[model samples]
Target: MKLTIVSRNPKSTKFPVTLELAGTASTIKTSDVNKALAAKFPKYYPDRQRLTTEDKKVLDLDKTLEEQGINEQSSIYFKDLGAQIGWRTVFMIEYAGPILIHPIFYYLSKFIYGSSFTHSPMQTVTYYMVMAHFFKRELETVFVHRFSHGTMPFRNVFKNSAHYWLLSGANLAFWVYGPWFAQGRAAAVRNDVWIYGSVAVWAWAELSNLITHITLRNLRPPGTRVRAIPYGYGFDLVSCPNYFFEFLAWTVVCFLTTSWSAFLFNIVATGQMYVWAVKKHKNYKKEFKDYPRNRTSMFPFIA
Candidate 1:
C-alpha cells in the first residue's frame, strides 16, 4: 500500500511525501500514530491525537483508518512550518479528560423514573407505531451516541459537563424506551391524552431541539479552540436563545407524551439543563460585562 503524506505549515511550507506499507485496518490506532511519531520525530513529538488547527479544525484519530476511508493509495496532508508537526498530528488517546457524568445521570434517572416494566410506557407501548419512526430520527440525531454508537462532538463534552449530562441523559432515556426498547418485543410507550394535542406538543418540542442544534452547528461549529463546546460565542448576549428553545422543546415533549414516565423523564432532564443554562447566562453577563442588559435570563419578561 502506498500512502502519501503532505505537510504544509501555516508558514506556507508544504512537503508531500509518500510511504509504502503493507498492513490491515487492525494495525492502525492512535497508538500506532504515536509510535510512528516517536520513530518519525522522536525528539519533540507532540500529541498528534489532537490535530486541531489554529482555527480549530480537528480530525478524529480514533476513527478506524478504514472507517476514515483512507486507502493505501490515500494521501494524508499536513502543514510544515520548518518543524515536525508531531504534537499536532501524532494521535494519542489521552485519558486526561474528566470522568464523564453519564453514570450519575443514569442512576438518578432510574431512581426518579422508576424501573421500566415489560409493558411500561417506556417499553414503547403504543405510540402510533409510525410516530415512533419519526421520533426515531430525532433520537438518532440528538441522542445518537447511545443508539448508533457514533461519536459526540468533542467540544461539546469538554465545554460544559452539566450541559453534557442533561443532553446525554435525555437522549439515553428517550432511546431506552423508544425504538431501542420497543424493538423486537412490542411498543411499550403510549398516551391516552388528547391525541393530537399530546403528539403535537412533543413534536413541537423536538422541532425546537432540531432548530437549536441547527443554529449552533451553523454558527459555532464543532471545531473551535475557545471551548470544547464552542462557548464565547458572545452569542450569549441574546440570553441563551438555545436554552429557551431547548426548554420549550423538552417541556412540550412532556406535554405530548402525557405518559407520566416520559413526562417525568423530560421534566427532570430538561429542567436540570434549564438551570445550567440560566447559570451560564449569568456567567456570560459577568464575563462580557457589556452583555446586553436588556436581554432576559430566559423568557423576555424575566421569570
Candidate 2:
C-alpha cells in the first residue's frame, strides 16, 4: 500500500512511501508508519512522536492507520503539538484559576452564609488581600513574565487549574471567611496588633514580588531565551526572591487569619517553591560561571 506523508508547512516537500500489507492479518499502527518516516526522513521527523495530524481535524496517534480510515494514497500531515496551546494560554489559565475560584467562595460566605460586612471587617480585608494577590498574578502573567517555551502539554492546564482552584477554595472559605462569621466581630478584632502587622507584611511582600518579576522579565528581549544572573532587588540575597516573597505573603495571611487551613496551605506551598528554587539555583550555577555563590535557594541565609 502506498501512502503520502505531508508536511503542515506548505513550502515543505511531501513524500510517498510503500508499505507491505501482504504478510499478516495485523493492521499497521501509527508507530510503524512513524518508524518508516524516521528512517526515510530522519531530519524532518527526528522525534516520530510529533509526526501526526488529521488535515480535516485531529488524528489519534494510538489508532492504526487503517482504523483511522487512512488508506492507500491518503495524506497524513505532520504537525508539532507545541504550536497548539501557547505559553500565554498556559499562564492565563493558571493565574485565572485562583482569581475566579477565590472570589466565588468569598462572596458565597457573605451572601449564602449570611456573613455580612458588619459581622467582621477583618474578613473583608482578608478577602480583598487574597483577590489582590491573584489579580496581581494574572497581570504579571500577561505583562511581566517571559516564557521560554511557546507551549506546554494541554493536560497541564487542567492539572494546574485543579491545584489552584481547589486549594484557594479550601483556604479562603474555611480559614479566612468562615471563621470570621462563626466567631463574630469581637473575636475577629481581638488580635489588633497581629492583624495590622501581617497586613503590612503582606503588602510589602506583594510589592517586592512584583518588582522581582519585572526585573527578571526585563533581563531578556521578546522571543529570546537568554538567561542572565539576576541582580538587585531581593536577588542579591536569594536566588529565587520571587518565591521567597510569595512564601512571606502567604505566611502573613496565615498569621492574620489565624487559620490552620491557611497555615497548612502555606507549608505545602512554601515547601514546593523551596524545592523548585533549589533546583533552579543549581541550574543557574551550572549554566553561568559568574552566578553568585552566596545566594541561597529561596531564603536570605537559610534554605
Misplaced by over 4 Å in model 2 are 1-84, 110-119, 179-187
lDDT of 2 by residue, 1-303 (tens): 556666665664444344444322137766676666767656534332355545455554456776777777577766534324566877677667667766666667666555455436567777788889988988888888898655666656777666566676555555566645445555576467776777899999999999999999999899777879889999999999999999999888887777777787788788889999999999999999989889999999987
Worst 10 residues of 2 by lDDT: 16-25
lDDT of 1 by residue, 137-181 (tens): 344344331111123333434344433333433443444443334
The TM-score between candidate 2 and the true structure equals 0.70
In angstroms, give how far residue 117 of model 1 lies from its true place: 13
**Error at 95, model 1, angstroms:** 22
For candidate 1, the per-residue lDDT at 211 reads 53
Error of 2 at 223 (Å): 1.2
* Runs in model 1 lying further than 4 Å from the true structure: 1-193, 226-238, 256-258
